[model samples]
Target: MRLNIKITFFFLFITKVCLAQDWMQTPIPGIGNIEFPSDPEIFDQNGVLIYKLENDDAFYLVSIAQTDPSYNAEIEANLEEYYEGQLEGVEEASGGTVTFKQDIGIDGVSAIDARISGVANPELPSLLFKRFVYVNSFNVSAEFRPKKTDELEFTALKDQFFNSLQLDVSALGSSIVVDEVNGEKDAFKKGYEIGYVIGRIAFWVFLVIIAILVFYFIIRLLRPKKKKEPKATASKPVTKQKIECTNCGKSNSTEAKYCSQCGYTLPRD
Candidate 1:
């Protein structure tokens, strides 16, 4: 039952991806329109269409991926619809896999355009890659690189995709040096601009307040309570209290045994 539920969710996830996303032309008018190629699930492979827009020697390649909601479990039921009624290829049961088949499209005629494609070993939440291969417009021997990162590295996927890259092909075209690559994402800068700094400050202040409250509670819970000091009973001062008896006109000392002037017994304490 649990396995059925998991599969059901996966199908729902695929359905969502198929239903929500529609191919639309992006910018630059109708230089190109992408068609959803037959979504085929190859056995251990993912694919996507890459469209390159080149103007004045500046090229921007955008990869369009078509696949079931591998990331979502809601629309797994519609996975077949995304595949156009095709089943996914058999894969090792140890790890889950989703496949995508892609067609690269470059609009218009390029007198000279160099291109490359390749897969990459993933690091983390980064998109999985295959490799990168370079080819000249002339279809002649161009270049191929398997390395992920190096100075003057040709094909590498770092962070998000970047568009502003300078193509430094010498006049002779014997060597190629790609420089002036722009548009590397400023994740922190963007986050900070959107009040990340303020959020961090608020978080720290909240933590400090929590710490102080915790310490106060601990000390309060641990410290011994006083016995109220027993309220030091206020001592009454001894007041001189002399008395005279009317019967004998006798003057008596306060708390005296008898009056000295008369042989009369006085009230004594």
Candidate 2:
């Protein structure tokens, strides 16, 4: 009886272990959800969830976040950088050798896919596959590895994770990429530059017009004023005395003192 009880207890324990390993689907608020291994380590940093799954041979990390608005115009160029940019520290941390890397698209969304093999620590050489997907305003990345201390095998695991991804289109928002002709110069920037140039030209034109008006007024104010001429007056005529030359006329009797023909004095009135 005790032996049967012990057997039953062992069976129950085995069943519990199996149940613990079963995969489960969970929804991440504001993002989407996926079927991950049971009891995966989930961390929420700044509203973003960083989920991690591990086994005897490999480990996987999946994270989702929104794309920054400042980087929207250069989305295409940013997608090109799979190694030196976003994965800046991976090579240093894992001492891994990148095997293959490529850029792909799905339903208008852009992505980067890469595979690497390296020693994560002193004991084991790990193989890792990483995929970065750009969905509208969000960015989703997954790093999968096979065995922590085993040979690098990524094909099977890569397929599993990629297949299970369920993205919520509404949560991703709208695409932020801006088509540009020059380096990072979009329509807004170009329009602003053109507007600035036009504004400067208009300001100079206004200044020129003001200067011309000022010069015209100044010339008018500096001109000399005309003086008025004085009016002419008529002069009186002078009368000549008849007593002149009375002494020589012979009719010089009337109170004549002297006459003009001879040296004589004239009478006073």
Instruction: Please tell me which predicted candidate would have the highest lDDT against the true structure.
Output: 2
134-232: candidate 2 lDDT, tens digit per residue: 655567788776663323344555566665666676765443221211223233346656765786676667556655655565565667777988888
Tell me how candidate 1 scores on lDDT. Answer: 0.33
Report the error of model 2 at residue 85, Å: 1.9
Expressed as tens digits, the lDDT of each residue in 204-269 for candidate 1 is 675566556555665766689877665678889988878775458777777667677776777644
Against the reference, the lDDT scores of all candidates come to 0.33, 0.60
* Alpha-carbon TM-score of each model against the true structure: 0.30, 0.47
Root mean square deviation (Cα) for candidate 1: 19.1
Model 1, position 194: C-alpha lDDT score: 60
For candidate 2, the per-residue lDDT at 183 reads 25
Give candidate 2's root-mean-square deviation (CA, Å).
31.6
